[model samples]
Target: MRQSFGERFDVPDGYLNTASIGIPSASAGEAVAAAVAGWRSGAGRAGEYDEYVERARAGFAALVGLGADRVATGPAVSALVGLVAAALPAGARVLVAGGEFTSVTWPFAAQADRGVTVTEVDLAQVGPRAAEFDLVAVSVVQSADGRLVDLDGLRAARGSGTRVLLDATQSLGWLDADLSWADAVVAAGYKWLLSPRGVAWMAVGPELAATPVAAGWFAGADRWAQIYGLPMTLAPDARRLDTSPAWYCHVGAAVALPWLAGLDRSAVHTHCVGLADSFRAGLGMEPAGSAIVSVTRDGAGERLAAAGVVSAARAGAARLAFHLYNTEADVARALDALTP
Candidate 1:
C-alpha cells in the first residue's frame, strides 16, 4: 500500500474488500474515540448530540445532492426500506429484481402482509416496464456481480405515477448517483461510506419526506418536551422517519461522511475504475464500469488471502473492489496471487 491518499487507513497488505466493509479513515476512528470519551465523562452539552446527527445528515445530503432536511438517519438499510415500504400507497404494485440484496427485496416482500403486491422481474425487463408498476426498487449496483444499474435509463422509463427507490449501499460513496430520479434512497454506512456498522442514512424526495408515518419517540416534534406526557406530533420533515441510532455511530459518521464529501469523487471513481480494469486486464478479462471486478474461479479468494491479499467470493465469482486507498502494487500483488 502506497501513501498516495495521505494516511487514510493503516493499510492492510492487500485489501480489496471495501464492498464488504470499509476500513475507516484515521480521522473517523479518532472521532469515535472522542465520542466514547464524551459519553464516558458525561460532559456533552445540550444539543451536542443533535449537532452530531445534523452534521452527518448534512454530509450525506451533500453526497447525494439533496437537502439535509430531506435526509434521515437509521440503524440499517433494511430498516430504512421498511420505513419506505410502510409509507407507500396501500396495495402498491412493487417491482424488484429476482435476486437482489435481501435488504432491497425483503422490505417489499414483508409488505405482502400489508396487501402490497411484490413482483420480481428480470433485470433486463425492469427498465423498459418500470412505469407499469406503482413502485420500482432495486440496488444501484448488484451486490453479487458488481453490476452498475443504468440510473438514467430507469429515470427515463419511469412514469408520473411510478416511484423509484434505490438501495445504494454498494455505490454511494464511490459512484456518482443522480438522486433526481429517485423517490427515496437508502445506504448502509459500513461499506463505501467508510464508517463502522450500525450507521445508515435514507434521503427522501420532498413528497415522501413530508408524509406522516407511525414514528418512534425520536421522531416526535418535541421528544424531550413530550417526555412529560405532553401531546406528541410527528416531526415535519425527514427527521420523522429517523430511527434512533447509537451515539457512537452518529459520531463516527459525522466525521467519516465529511471525509467522503471532501473527496474529489470523480477523480477517486476514475482511479478505482482504472484499477479494476487493470486487475481485469491482468486476469485476461474484460473491462468493467465500476470498481468491482468478478472472476469465475473456485478458491480464488482463499488463494488470494493466502498470498497476502483479501477478496470475496459471491455467487461463484471471486470479487475484487478497488477504492481510493488501493494502489497499483496492491493490484499487482492480487494479480500475482490469483495467477496460480
Candidate 2:
C-alpha cells in the first residue's frame, strides 16, 4: 500500500528480477560512493573499517532476530558453506536437496576428502530422512521455481545430534524465518537485501561451536597480534569463523541497513507478494508461496525483454521476482509484454 518504497530505486519499466541481482537502493549507492571518496581522500581510519564490519553484523542480527555476536561475514555464500563443511567430522552423512544451487551442494560434496558423503534427495523427502543424517542442509526457497521448503516439518524431524544448515539466499528479506530451526544460516546479500556484490553473511547458533576450515587473520581474537609473531587465540564466538569481508560491502551494507530498517518489513513483503500474485493471475497461473513467478514458454526471456520487461530464464521457465520496489503497474507491464 505504501508508495514510498518504490521511490528508493531508479529501475527500468517492468524490471522485476530481484532474485538474480537486486537493484541497490539510492541510499546504498550513495553510501558506497561516500566510502570510495573517503578512501581516495585518505580520510578513512582503521577503526572506521572495524566499525563498518560491526555495524553490518548488527544490522543482519536485527533482521534475523539473532544476537549480533552470532552473525559473521564472508565474501560469498560459497565461502560460508565451505566453513560449515570444515566444522563437520569426517565420514559425516550430509543430506541435501538434489538440484540445489551449486554453492550449497558442492561445499559438502567436497568434504568427500574428509570421508564425508553427500547424499542428494528430493526436497520433499529431506524432512523424513533428516534424522538419519549427521547434517541436513537445504534452501529456504527453491531457486529454479518459487517452491518453499517446509521448515516446521524439517525441524520436527531433526534428531538431537543432527545439525541443520540453511541457505537463505532466496527467502531472508521477503519471508519471515525463525533462524532457531537451523544450526547455521548463510545467504548472499546481493539478492533480496539490495546490497552490492561480494557481500554475504552467516549466523551460527550459540550452542554450536564451529571451526573455520580456512581461518585468516581476521578470524583471530586479536587480529594484529600475530603481526609480531606472538601467540594468537581464535575469537571466542562466531567471529572466529569469519572470512575477510569485502571492505566496500561492509560499508555499503552497514549504510543500507538503516534505510531498510526504516521501512515496514511486513508491509514490504505483502506488497511484493501481491505484485507476484497479480502477475500470476494475469498470466493465468496459480498463486505461489514466495515472490517468484515462473512461466514456461519457449524464448520467454527474449520475448519479455523485447517488451521492456526484464526477467531471468531458468530451467526453461521465465522467472520474474517481485521486490519492494515493484508496483502493480510493473506487474501489469510484464503481463502485457508476455501476452501473445
Candidate 3:
C-alpha cells in the first residue's frame, strides 16, 4: 500500500534478507562514508562523536517509548544481557523461549556456577509459566521463524512480579509496541534497524536496579572530565550501564535511527507484513501475520539464491524477511524461486 519508504534503500531487486542484515538507508550510508573520509584525512574530532551517540540514543529511546535517560548505548545485546545476568542473585531462576536467540539466553545460562538456572520452554508457555521463575528473558520476535511473542501476556506476567527482559533485535524497526514495562529491553542495530554493526541499545525499567558491573570511563557522571579517576561516579540513570560506543557505527545510527523514529512505524509494519503475507499467499500458505516468513522446503535457500533472491537458512528453513525497503516485486521474485 503505502510503500514510499522503499525508495530510501539502494538494494538489488531481490534482496529480502533483512533478518540477517539490513542495507542502510542512502543517507546513513553517505554519512558513514563521509565520516570515514574525514577520519582518513585526520579531520575527525573524537569529542564531536559523542553528539552522534546521544542523538542515536535519544532516537532509540523515542522508538521504544522511553525517556532517553532510561536508555544506554552498547556494543551488542549479549554484552547488555551479561550486565543483567551479573546482577541476578545466586540461585536465581530465569525462563526463556525454547528457540530464543542465544544472546538473550546464554548470558543467564553462563551463570550456572552461581547456582543460577536457565529454563527453556515453549514461547507460549513463557508467559503462563512466568510465575515459576524470578525473571523471564525472551525475544520480542523469534529470529528463527519470526514468531511474535505475546506482549500482553508478558505484561501480565510482569504485573504478577516476574521481571522481564526483552530482546527487540528482530522486531524494533517495524514492530510498533511500547516496551516501557519490561525490566530491560535490548536490541542490536544491524538487523531491522538498518544501522551499521557495533551499535546496540538497552533500556532499563524501574523494576531492575542493575549495577554497572562493567563500568568504564564512558559510564562516568561526566565521562570526559572524570576519565582519569579512582572513585568512579557513574550516571544516575541507565547511562551508568553504557558500554563504550563504537563511534563510526553511532555516526551512521545517528542518521538512521532518528529518521526511522520519525517515520510512520505503523505504515512500515503494515508494508512489511503485507509483503510477507503476499509471499505466503503465493506459496499457498496461510498468512502468518509476521514480517518474516520461514519455509522448510528442500533446497529452498539454494533455489532462492539461484534466482537472485537473497535470504537466509536458519533452523533448517529458508528465512525471508520483509522490511520497509521491500515491495510486492520482492515477494513475487522469492515466490517464483520457491514455487514448484
Compared with the true structure, model 1 gives a TM-score of: 0.93
Per-residue CA lDDT of candidate 3, range 172-291, in tens? 999877887788889999998989999899999977967687899999899999889599899988999998889999999999899889989889888889999999999888997789
Shift in Å, residue 9, candidate 2: 1.2
| Candidate 3 Cα outliers beyond 4 Å, as residue runs | 1-3
Best by TM-score: 3
User: What's the ranking of the predictions by TM-score, best on top?
Assistant: 3, 2, 1
Best-fitting candidate, scored by lDDT: 3
> What's the lDDT for residue 11 in model 2?
70
Alpha-carbon lDDT of model 2 = 0.81
Question: How many clashes would you count in candidate 3?
Answer: 0
User: Which pairs clash (backbone N, Cα, C closer than 3 Å) in model 1?
Assistant: none
Q: Give per-residue CA lDDT, model 2, range 1-340, as digits (tens).
A: 2335644676777887889998877777788899899989999776578888888788787777778888888889888888878778888999989888899989888879889999998888887888888888899888888777878767875546778888888887777667655888888888888888897888888655566877778888887664345465778888888877678888878866555655677887788788898888887888885898888977778888988898998878898999888888888788778786
lDDT of 1 by residue, 1-340 (tens): 2454554577696899998988888888888888788878987664578777888889998888888878888888888888878776778888887788899888778878768998887777777778788888999888887887767757875645678898888888888657645888889999888887998998888655323344677787876665445566767888888766677888888888877888888887888889989998998988877888887877788888888888888888888888888889889999988886
